[model samples]
Target: MSVGSENLPQFALVGGKGTGKSSLLESLVGKDFLPRGATRAPLVLNLRKSDCQEQGIFLHRPGEKIHDFSRIREEIANRTVILAGLVRLSLDCQPDNFVEQTKSTIMEYISKEETIILAVTAEGLVMSQALEQAMMVDPEGARTIGVITKLDRAQDIAMAELDNKVVPLKWGHVGVVLRSEAVKCWKY
Candidate 1:
């Protein structure tokens, strides 16, 4: 069964490049459906609650396209679907960056009732800068939440920086230590 876009609450996951956005989504949706490489354009994962499966992915570039991946897990029946937001471009892109544009688009989709998760990695200072820019675009960050990925790779210095709250985020931080994988997914 397919759920219309209007009925669900959009839950976006915004962050800089290589912040483990796709990996987080795979963990949440309980499948390795989404591609971990750079997203070329915005895409919507059509998730259905009753079936506990990802029905299709609605790609937003080169016109809307749909792809089906059949993998169902019974454990997701009781859980609901919330839109996960991810930008198709890097936050540090030069010449013509799409971070601002993407944030604006996401702001339009989210209602006053929904929340947005900001994914940040503890490996660099760039994550903090990206968060600040996001806050500027969506002040109040009223419904924003921060997820700090790559806790396992954080060094003593990086851990100290995080502990000091060097870059203050309004919604607070939740650290996630992803298990080491053979592929070495993170790119900078």
Candidate 2:
């Protein structure tokens, strides 16, 4: 059964390229739901908990519900999917190179009172554009959750960041590490 868009809680994943936003979502779902490679547009995934053992994915358009995973990349790349449900919004990693249009778009979503912002950052990185934006919008960090990916590659600098010595968030931070190449899963 499908849940209505209005009923599901909204979560916006704001991170740069290669920050593992897609991977994080995939791991959470316990399946390879999103397509590989760079996400060109905002992909809204309506995740529903199922009682059955099997997992299913569907692409919802205006008049169609597609179950083929192979067509997902094309639909996203073509910007054909209707924007609804839980959205994963990706931003450029480099703050210096951040485009004004993208920044404005991100600002709009994060500023909303209902949207929960997932500020994702990678280990060994001092700062994240996503995190910086989230902090700017919500100074108290009440609705933002800091997700630190690639903990295996973390250095001493990362430890400081993790300890909240560098940047403190009211919600705090969670570190995740990729376990193995075969499994391609993260250990939180």
Candidate 3:
């Protein structure tokens, strides 16, 4: 099927800084392609499932279409790209103004009825700004799915949230424990 012909499920990852949004994306793609640090603009990853040995990865920036596989990661990390697929909007919870801007951008998508994956740190679940924004926009939890990050840091609290005892949602919550830089070097 052609890209535009079929209606693919679009997921939007929304969260504040240090909330593991990029790490979740990396885990989904099974690669560490996204650059480390904060993202300036929203990223739309057009991922296609295929059986081919080699898959094509393209990055379309404003005024240029990049086809070089080696440059895809760098290009996406360095600048913004516009495409149609899964959208991930990072909320930088710093300097105050940026947070408001991020919230506005997220509201635009929410108005469009996009599926929202609200990322919240396990330790800060009750006070997570990301969760607050999501609940404010989607009080009924119709399109919001809470993602509890840093589960390893606070398993008990994360479990409570996952059980919906802390904050209930219609779609429910998912807990993810991503390895930190310090744990990356250690063996199982």
Candidate 4:
């Protein structure tokens, strides 16, 4: 299908800082391509096939200044799910209004029939007010889903949050436990 005519499913990864958004992306794509640390602009990851090629695009916000990385394209693939155009938001210690831009950006994509996945860790429950509001904007949960990262770190709390509706994810919550970084060496 041609790029202009085809409407691919877009997913936005909304979360607070140090919540393992990049790590999840790297694991899903099977590569460490996304830049670590503060993410200045939202990115659109275009996944076409699973051959380990580099294919991605850095989306620019409306009326925002353009930069060298504003527009990018690469080809890559991996096992499991291959989702592109993953929008990411860094909501650490920033003003509430700052998230407006992110909400608008995601809303634009949702209006175009895209999906948004809110990524958050178990410890992030205390810091989920912003995310809760973000999800409430699409309260029916038609366009948003919640992902709980770092399950190993807070399994009990994660369960309680999801069960008690503390976070109240309309689409429900998915728990993920990443392997320990120290156990990298293979024993077999």
TM-score of each: 0.58, 0.68, 0.67, 0.57
How much lDDT does candidate 2 score? 0.62
**In model 1, how large is the Cα lDDT of residue 64?**
30
Judging by lDDT, tell me the better candidate of 2 and 4: 2
Where is model 3 more than 4 Å wrong at Cα?
1-8, 49-70, 80-99, 122-124, 181-188
lDDT of 4 by residue, 1-188 (tens): 46651365655566665677666666666655554444444445454433554434323222232222223212122210133222344344544455566667655654455556555554745467436645556756665555667777777666765552665555666666543452121110
lDDT (C-alpha) at residue 110 in model 3: 57
Better of 1 and 3 by TM-score: 3
Clashing pairs in 1: 11-83, 12-85, 13-85
Cα lDDT for residue 102, candidate 2: 59
Q: Per-candidate RMSD vs. true structure? A: 9.0, 6.6, 6.8, 9.4
**C-alpha lDDT values of all predictions:** 0.51, 0.62, 0.60, 0.51
lDDT of 4: 0.51
What lDDT tens digits, residue by residue, belong to model 2 across residues 97-132? 335555677787788777788898775324688888
Error of 4 at 117 (Å): 2.4
